[model samples]
Target: MQANIRHQVSPYLVFFLIYNSQVGVGILSFQRTIAAKAGYDAWIGVLAAGCIVQVFIWVMYKLLGKANGDIIDVHTNIFGNVLGKFISFFIMIYYWLASVSVLIAFIEIIQVWMFPTMPSWILSTLILFSVYYCVSGGFRVIVGMSFLSFIFPQILIIVLFIFPLKIAHFSNLLPIMNHSFMDMADSIKSSIYSIAGTEALLMYYPFIRDPKASKKFAHLGVLFTTFLYTISTIVSFTFFSENQLKTTIWPELSLTKTVTLSFLERFEYLYISMYLIIICALIALFLWCSSRGLKKIFNRKQKYTLLLLCLLSVILCHFNGSFKDMLNKYIIQMNLWIFYCYIPILLLVLSFIKRGKQNDE
Candidate 1:
């Protein structure tokens, strides 16, 4: 299915799409998780992970540039048709799993912190339906939604973080590099899940008006996400001691509790509401990618594929129990392997193949 010229988004929207995708629920809790592994120097791990992501983005652009198409075409170019379709089918499943995981996770958060009495399935239905609406409108609508997601919450959220400074102990960040190199490396590995979203570019690149011009903007998105994560890590590290951080699940959310306003109490509640916009943007992007993959692999319409995926997401969200946590952990592990290990290997294979073909010419 060729993307219509009327439907293609501008090159610069790539920045918002990549940035919104990367800065999801992961940023809210990543500090504690990484700090648990590397101690105070975990902020270093954030920087390292960002740099690693930049490299992967470069590799992805090179691969896509060679194929002159999306990842489906890349696979078909590298592997034969039958094998490529099989691999792309698995990628569709991977994208579905990612959508389900994000939906369930955000539902759990709302249930725990905002509305304990509300049924999980109700929120799940609402959220999935919203995602379906945006995705069914096509890629341009998804891009517009992502732009709003990036602009709406960012300024207020960053301002809220400033309140924590009254109680922040900058001294908590002292003795930096106190952790062993191996520990910091482990933290970087752990941080990969939080930084995993840029790989979506492999699938969406062909939809951009000028795919080549978007490369730098895409890298800028990664840089922007890295800056946000680094700032969050440093703030969390400064606001809480090592032991305190290890115990806090959502350190960023918890930090909002310290903010006192004249008219509003429980500022975290407002923050959570604002966060739904980001979550919606994330789920929409994943679902769109999944549906588009299905269309490519099976010669089906995206509308039907999107409806199927949205229903599946709602079902998964409703039935998710203790297993939800396990599934999330496994998805993170899969993402780490897929983006870090598999993509690089694929790039090398494509490079060698291109060189051999050039020699034959």
Candidate 2:
């Protein structure tokens, strides 16, 4: 007999998972990526991007709640049978690609910081299997795992900021708007990429115990995430010169190296070791969401579909050239527009249209 699975995530847990997932390895590289384009005003660019993302998340939740359906049903109502299926299929593909790219990026980060001698294929497969195992266990299990993963964030924040009074120079963040607004605008695309994972809300909406609570939690979650991000960014900037920071690939980790603790020669290693848990949780969340998206769009068997997604992501990770370069070419560009602007605007329009039709009827 098939077992009936229920979504057991509370609003707070939902908030944690979404917030943590959004604050992944992307934060490690965001400063350099955006600073390259926006100069010292990258924080301003990130703020602008956050505002846009919040509006988009609001619009998405409104549309999804109004339609009161999964992604497939939402699209079907908005675009009609054929076109809706087409669009839903497009979204499904997008989610899959995003999941794969995130997985590859996480692996690349590990390779760079911790395991230089490990083979990429072995690392990729191990991580993919771990993600798939959690995903196959169902949403409640994954959310539960996410709550436990919260330990990593607690440890990370504490380790990195304990002696905060001594290590950093606050002046690095001042005179922040030294660059033109035009430069900030040019870098908005990359800033959007750094905070890109929140769109997972579109897929996980139905799992939220009280759908109505999503808006409240999502807003609160975004606020909290922004606060943490800004603090972390400021700390990193304050610790390293803009010129030195630009050369570091993962400035977050590099900044952690400044921390001095008893019984610890290299705290960054401990931080990285703990961060592996956080990244694993993120991978599980993304993989599960991606699988659910495919099942919703195509009416596929969930188990088989998730397995297929895991295999596909592993394959994508193996594609030639640097994972960073591949992500820039494909996932970053694709999601920069889709997650940041297009999908959100589209959802707003759909929500308006659906409400209008209901009132008319």
Candidate 3:
């Protein structure tokens, strides 16, 4: 059930893969979204959500580790091939649509900031071309892209947070926990969706060279991203007044506006450009999961499946005038329920089934 040795990656790379998957276009605007319900207390909600994600990570590892393969294997072993693939088809489609959602969100950013007149198809096609190239090279290549995404932009982006801190109104976060428990719950809910993509680990479990050894690295990866997000939420909360943050979109990108250099007066442009690495890496990983799942389910060639997905993604983006909002909403709900709710139930059921089989044997 394990992937071939040549196709597997080092255990440590789990950190970068988790990092790449979690950090995407959501980071750009999540502050305002989380703040809407809980006011300044939303950062605490973010930490809470991260805790939930850590628990979910533990669940996924336990489930996938027992199967010793991807979710597809888990499904087939439990449900028989037909019904298992029937259920798994929904998850695969979720992966493909998740990639498209990221694609459209980033494309919207490019249109607004970088290219006002550029067509959606052109941008979608351009980005997917890079994603296809990386993904077609196989899982190792996708992980390589993830590693590059982590190394190149992350440290520099963290340094950029200093610019906003210079003028940050730290008192804006005073009188914390002012929001009601209900409001805090709302904020945590929003934060959970924003910090999603860790569930991508389920599909790629077998590709880890030593899945057991990688468990700590996987938890470490989520721990790192949780802190990254909490720090980002704190920075955004301090830098913008409650009212101002509510009004602004892309507050993280706005923070970059404070960053000025002798060579570069417009740093947000560079910020968006650098984000291509993070965004493309995410798209590549999601599509790899989607296409690989489909290949296994249908016994079809992976290349054909991947190419069809890229084409469908492009077509969806081109016609995305009204569908964008709906797409995001659907994917958000799907990520929350499927990964958080149904996945845990699945783990429970799988444990019972495996135990019963062992007793029978």
Better of 1 and 2 by lDDT: 1
Reference-based lDDT, residue 345, model 1:
93
Model 2 weakest lDDT span, ten residues long: 1-10
For model 3, the superposed segments whose C-alpha errors exceed 4 Å read none
Superposed model 2: Cα runs more than 4 Å off = 1-5, 320-323
Worst 10-residue lDDT window, candidate 1:
1-10
Shift in Å, residue 160, candidate 1 = 1.6
- Measured by TM-score, how close is model 1 to the native structure? 0.97
Clashes of 1: 0
The superposed Cα distance between candidate 1 and the true structure at residue 301, in angstroms, equals: 1.3
- Tens digit of lDDT per residue, candidate 3, span 151-223? 9997668767988899988899999878799999999999998989998998999899999999899889999
The collision pairs in model 2 are none
Candidate 3 clashing pairs?
Answer: none
Task: Give lDDT tens digits, candidate 2, residues 55-163.
Answer: 8777777767777756666777778877887776766677777666666777777778788787768887898788788888888877877777776567677667656
Number of backbone collisions per candidate: 0, 0, 0
Please, what is the TM-score per model? 0.97, 0.91, 0.98
